[model samples]
Target: MRKHWTIVTGLLVIGSVWLTACSDGKSGQSSVDSDKPAEQAKSYANEPAELVIYGAPGDPPEVWNERFGDQLQKKFPNYKFTYIQRSGTNTIENMIASGAQVDLIYDSVGNAVNSVVATGSQLDLSELVKKHNVDMSRFEPATVEAVKQFGGLYGFPVHSGGLVLYYNKAIFDKFGVGYPKDGMTWDEAIELGNKLTRNDNGTQYIGLGQSYIHVLSMNAYSLPFVDKATEKAAINSDKYKKIVDTLIMAPAKAIGYKEQIATLKRLFNNNDFMKERNIAMYVMNFGLQGQKDFESLDWDMAALPVFKDNPGMGTQPYPNFLFISNASKYKDQAMEVLKYVTSDETQLALSKKGYIPVLKNESIKNAFAQDSNVKNKNVVKAVFTNKFASPIARTKYDGKLNSPLQTNLIKAILGEIDLNTALRQTEEEVNKAIEAEKKK
Candidate 1:
């Protein structure tokens, strides 16, 4: 799945009251001017300022253009907005290195936050967040903390995607099994999976299918790849080992095997598993892809099962962040756009397009309530409520460190290496990568 981040700059400090204005011979609503006090009209009226926004490719820019860009163009006659599209973090890294005079950059909080901060391409938005009195009350507390690294706020979130359990409701009903509950444990999920698995004629059904082991790893450890405060590899700890063991040993042992490749192929290609809807559960991110599949099947989503003892340890999800470029001349104007986009109205509007808006206001909740297709409301609500676990610790050298660790993890699951050896090798590789990054 593609992760998108949108950073806005040059937002006007406008009041919260609404105002009416005539534009292009049409009467419409506009925000109150920034010159007014807090008690005044809630519209943004300011001189037009040009802004260069760099964002990930696809629907995000179009949504932004519709919600804020077009409106800003009409509201501020002097401002010209230009949007540049880039795909993937590699492109972003290249653009930054080429001295791209970008005013904003969007990225995920887990992978891109520390890297961007290290590059010094992003500005601290703390003052602007405070000046706008942007309500941080609506966000999941962990999400808020995720955006804050070392004492400065590098970015603000526009939306998030959490982990959820997508199950075939038709298959469950056919087998006389109950649907997965909102809060379930790993053990319980396995039991449910066992009950759901069956064979129809010559085809076999599976209980669970997982695309990414990292998701399982996250649910187990409840931390990012690196500890933000400690700036070190924390995944080799006992807690993480338990997580790794559970995901690998439990499922492999149950099936009487240790090969993940075989498991994946068996789960996906087995006629009864996917084609026949014999599979009970598949763990995936909360995105349009899941919904697209859901539309084709009688499926529903629930929160990923938590650890038996640590009920709080749920799936790890990363939200994209918006940042202001250090090179932008129209910082104030960009800030205004940021503020406008983060507002409750805009957030709610975007939510309709299958995004979990960053704003935690009543408008967002009301919007979700009105949409019947958004069946994963409980999962979303849980994420916002911090019902999930903290992300795995990540280091600045995560690309170097995590890639190898992830590769070895896959190998371990395939039985190419034992769990203890994988862990030891991962520790060695992580320490080496950390050392290399420290030298730089």
Candidate 2:
């Protein structure tokens, strides 16, 4: 019989039903000694290797070189570092399909899906984490949970972005309405939206508008995409219906809200809130390097609206995670790089460049608050109020499921079909697709 090791409180020990691994006790002595894996393993810090970074599109090597590449090279003087700019949603998947020599992958959790985990390409870093004595507690609870869903400890977060309400103070002043304050509920936001959503001199001013993607991603109620036990699509449940009703329908009911939202999307589909200046309140994540866009406009952010029932819960977290490819021979070196990038020193350095560092260091948080160019904005509210929902455990066939669901949602919203009928049809269509996928 093979012995299994369990990861308890960030230490590896022989136990039942833990992170599945087949390391003989020949290498382990005790849980206390497990933290020395880095010292026990051969050091590759001086070995010649190129650490490939797969990040967002249009992100030049210079930006990453400045952020952490140079620091990584300084730590491992002999190792070379390079960046592979990601172009589309399937960039990493395409790399995997083509057998690219990928060392490390870093992307938003939204972009980096369960396929990486399901394909057995991402490294299981539980042991590396224990070896490095990385402080798991330093990361936010929600952030840590998000990484664990794909595979236990397969990666770590470098920075996080979450939903917040960006309100134009100038618009509020013009409408004689009080500016939105932190801790406001969705109901309160809608009430305020009613006041500000009107036409002034035929120049339409929409009160509240948030993108569908953001609203769905930041659902206050934690609804799973598929039921765990039956592996069935779970979008037609009462919980999911409430989520749609509150997040989608209620907001659309605001006066001329639909037309105004379409107009905003057409005006600047690039996610520039302040540039338009027509929308009073816009909801979105604190995107990487978007701080400068708000410089010219007099605007501030408020915490994302909470559920009246679930008062403290904000929304699911959005964090960018770093993973090592299982196929890479330099995985040990890649693990070393992963440890360094998510370290306190490295996270603090990146935070200065306008990232929400995953580490829960008081000074980093303070620095973020102090460095805010947008005055009177309670920037930290989103972090404190967040309660992350588990990422949906998806099948490879989900690509088929999302399309019909989204199409029907639009139809329901446009009065082509009722919400109940739409949900029922979506459920049937998705379950059929899941069944077909299982057959394959």
Candidate 3:
């Protein structure tokens, strides 16, 4: 029977990697000899197979094909790869719940937390790794450990990256404001942004304003939106309130609260930092491509700002993860694909395209400096200088409960609701969601 490629949506945390999938275009008996070398034997060599690959949001098919698909196809000519577009977290959850015949799931380790693993689609790859004698030690120990923490050998690391503050040097120079330094606290950064915002020649330059979603998603404090133990939204807590208050108030303090509300109504775009050159600092999950986008704009990046109390805690680590589905009929074939993609050769290939290869190999790390468009800048300090905040356990309703924090926070920022009121309202909405999920 021909397998169908499934398209579903899901959200996950940030990381950087290029992913590809390949299988024999047809499902059938293997043509390879059983007595071949173990590595050779597991290749499912010469079988016509079709690999179903489900993508996370923002990964484009063309980019995947260019990055790894063509090369993978050259390595395994008999295997045909199919790419399915991501619709959202809900879509992927539904597909997995329904037992879709997906071969691989691609996303950051964060996004996979409650969605894929909770759905029972993530396969335990410990046995397969042992059978293949794959040297898991070749990759970063932390990345490997991250996958293992998902409660089994649930996934493999592709690459790892994290959030940073990309600032426009020209904007800083124009405003007579100093550039953001690495390790600066959020309060210090905001104070600096207050200096950067001003009217220049009739054009209003935003000191620093990141998207509400970006702010909540990559909060340097890694504040939990839902307390997993209690399975309740923690929006109204003092810590969360402080974090949200700082974020919402900092930009408003910089540009004036009234103006900040007006700007929120219009919504700030990241592109404005580059094309319009009106935004001074854009905090986001920094990748090679994201850095390259600012090359012509005379910009540099600083490490993500730290919280005042948690001086060293930064945004969560984003590691690209590859998960083989438990429902996959071709475990051996899937393992082979995962092994190849995580191989040093493939890691090097992905690094050239701006991904931070998961391999601890110095050779691969050095390669990042060679072709990086922003290598001359402090890319290392910006991306690697900080420590990741502690991770929170995710529940099945985590997304539904957690997702509202962003939108409602946006409402609070836009002055439609007070921060405290917004927090209470979101907490109630999240409680309702949790209750609804329990009934189902």
Candidate 4:
């Protein structure tokens, strides 16, 4: 009778290696003969197998296949590669609770850690990466660092989407201001915003509806939410304070107090750049590929504005990682699949189709969005000219820290409270939450 892979309990890491073992009912050890070394085993690839790859919180099954499914299927024809879609009912927690085996989980680095890694079932791939001779240097350094910020090689990126300023040419033309240029500083961007913001014929054009949250979250300062050693809220420092004052509050305040709240709310809405066309300059990431109306508009791209103090730097990298799970018996097979996903051939193909390649290849950047829906604009200049700001440590408390920081920051932005009060309240709330998180 044929044997199947079963989930292993107590897969512990001893010393420098992951000392894990799973069985196929017939054997007390792994599927391979116990007499042979585990590394010497074929990783169960000799037989017909199924690998369950889970994607979550966003993206449908079809989208998954288009980006990864088809390519992975072609690369590994021996195994049946499955994509498990996370739905309202079928969550990561529920999937784990129900005793389903997920071989790999891929999503935005932030959400993936919060949903999947927080389950304590995530595999640190340091040993496996070394054993396979996977080159970590191929990826943008900061993205690799973001994964290690949790203190292990938890995962590696498949693709990236850093900040870029998308400006409406019509808005700039009407105002007769020269469009914002590449390498513009935060101070320069504010001055540009001041010129374009107006109530021309009662249209209420606000110049810098630049996705305020993205600007804050992906700030060039590389500020953390909580200090790892102190476990205290890290947002109260001068670095973070300057970020809020310069990026978050500046744009809304420029539009004037009467429309500040409404203008601030519009920051995340892309329609301000496309449909209403009232926003002059909106900074967004690669998610812009999904915008259908952008191609029809008179638009262009510029580098994300940098702070004068940190000139030639852009927002931190936001790369989506393909993570291997600890419970998987098909660890070798999963790593093989990841290798294919990040390979030069694969990354270049995806980059041409407007999915930003995670590999640090200039050729890939130059060819980016060549066949994409928004191919006409200068995408390389928009994204590739500046080095990504070094990213901060993404603690386990990152998801929890968002509420206090944003809520207090919003209140402060609207002048309901001062910036000092906002910072203090956030620190207290986050510190209290960190203590609570420790108990769990």
Candidate 5:
């Protein structure tokens, strides 16, 4: 019989399960340190002759391999890689229990904690990093710091999802509104949104739109949802107040007291800007360019809006990390693999395909969207027009904090509650959620 090691904290599992994975659905796998069959025993990471790698969602071998598998095979044909995907009961936990390889984990920060940290299979790569002379300075500083945000240096960030401002050219031309430039502040953006939000011939055109659910998470200010040090809610501060207030006003100049919440919901959707043909401007993830809905619009993109204090800043970096598990005995080989994963060659190929590279090199950043379906070179350049904000270290309660803040913000917008009351109520609710998680 095999013995299983349960995760230390249910809080990490709870938080991770609530948050979505980087590409696929959430996976709650366990770890193994038990005896197994002879053939299965041969699959450990120390047995470098055979190895396993978990890939991102897509195709049979995780779509990540579709592009780079051949390259890896050409260099090392004997390296057997089991690209473990989320298939029913065929989870990493089961594999480890069955004596299969446990090595590199390619996932986002949120899932990284849930998948490995929660299961206690994590292996810190700090010593290996120094041994291999990996240049931490080459990547964006935020991405490097973010890998260590949870505690130890678990992995390197290889890719990110970026934010950019999208606008409908035809809508601007019709409204006689000047097209938005790259560096408008949130206030200036609202003024532009105000011009476009009108019921022209009953069409009820919205001047501006945004991904409201994303605004708080990808905050340009790098504000945190909860403070890890105190394990308490950290959202009652002035910065949070400013963020909520800005979100309330960004879509409409003055939303009618009765229609405020419904109006925000309608405008916050991506479809409202793309398929519905109502929104003139929108703030969204840059990857939406590949959506089929984009083919119908006369649209282009601009840099994400900046705060007046910070002249030209982009949204915080939301990167996917390449984690190495402690279960692996071959740290040196794993370090080399991580090196190849972040090399300029791998970064360039993925960048052309619109996977935002983590490297800080201007040439690599500039190459973004060059090979995508996007035909406009100028539009591609706008993605890097501003400097990216550092990532906010995430906490287990980020998802819990999102709702209370949005609810109170809407109440404040409708005059049902003032800013002080809204934030006060939000903090109370956040603390309650935290207490409940602790009890579990």
Candidate 6:
């Protein structure tokens, strides 16, 4: 059995650039005492060769670098592992386009994966998973299904994440409002938010913090920021219209209520929630980065409210996938490292540093429960366990189409554009993008 090591905490840099200079797996090397005895080291020398990994720069890596990366280097000296972290999706996409033969690529599930697949840069990992004895059963079924395409497994799960509602507990208590429950409806959440908001020194704070237009589009209609199949816009659904109405429009219409469109800008710059101590709720991802700033305030988290009729389901699960480049010279060695990195042991170790584990191992589950900073374990667990439906397929045009669609939608909410006309124009613009992509 592989040795299980724990990771230690350190100051987290929200986003950092990771760069690795070119080097052969051997030479210019430093050796550390191996955990394995001499005989065992000799026995493991038969393992496959070195692998190169390229990943997006972000959380967990800053902390897990020493334990995870260093230990793997020591155990498998023959398998030289190099990690290069790029800043953004566009940078990573450029590297892939340039044919940088990376053994493993770390990226978001939908758009990033689809983009690379379009460029013919990724390998089909179905055989790799079987050969390495990856335990697919350990992952949530929906998460597993999300990575499959064209009857092939293009990638394996790395980290699983979903949206959840973050609320300042002190505000709820002050207003004599009950805390949000597991199955609370969106309408109930909105009403509760209204009750908690007030005019403080002439600055108005409505109930909930504003969400990104993209996130709003996702939760409301299960639409993807981009679509994979048609490479077109898929944002013109009735579900999205309802989302625009409730989350954007309805709130804007409330008397003395500030516009939701300006919510994110205000919260970040004005310390909207932190200052007033009256903001009821806001939605964000599971990682909860930048939350330390709110440590001085009492707060808790809840599941993103579900549509009343849509009951158990709340939000779509957005997970990151690890894929091997088809052009990699060290494909076999890379698969071995990928398997080790995604294994239950590694997943649990990474989760300790804030990345959500995809595996259902008891240790990872316990670690999540014991995390003191994570105010709402039940909400996270509920998102994983609930029988939620998969998100609707997104077209390649969705991302390009969202800005204008949201701009028009916001205008409708502000009573500038009538709802029907706004939606019709949105449909027309999105369809045009879809048609252009089809011709491409």
Compare the candidates by TM-score and give the number of the best one: 4
| Tens digits of lDDT, candidate 3, 296-323 | 7788889888887887878766687878
- When superposed on Cα atoms, how far off is each prediction in RMSD? 8.0, 9.5, 7.3, 7.8, 9.7, 8.0
Top model number, lDDT: 4
Which tens-of-lDDT digit does each residue in 90-143 have in candidate 2? 355655655555556666666565435655667777776666445577677778
TM-score, every prediction: 0.75, 0.79, 0.77, 0.85, 0.81, 0.77
The TM-score of predicted model 4 comes to: 0.85
Q: Candidate 4's residue-wise lDDT over 1-440, tens digit each?
A: 22222222221211122222211111111222246544533243334556776676457767777887776555555666555666656666766766677777777866766766678667888777665556677788888887777667777788888889888899899979998889898888888988888988878887776665577768888887777668778888777888888877777677553274545542345766778788788887747747778657888888888888888889899888877888888776677667767777788888998887887778987899898877887787888878988877766676666778777777887778988889889889988988998998
Model 1, span 136-165: residue lDDT tens: 665666566656642457666667767767
Model 6 lDDT-worst window of ten = 21-30
lDDT of 1: 0.57
Ranking by lDDT: 4, 3, 5, 2, 1, 6
Candidate 6 residue-wise lDDT, 196-288, digit = tens = 667657656567665555356447346554455655454456766677667666555555454434454222222555555545676766655
**Better-scoring candidate (TM-score), 3 or 5:** 5
TM-score of 3: 0.77
lDDT of 4: 0.71
lDDT of model 6 at position 410: 59
Candidate 6 global CA lDDT score: 0.57
lDDT of each: 0.57, 0.64, 0.68, 0.71, 0.66, 0.57
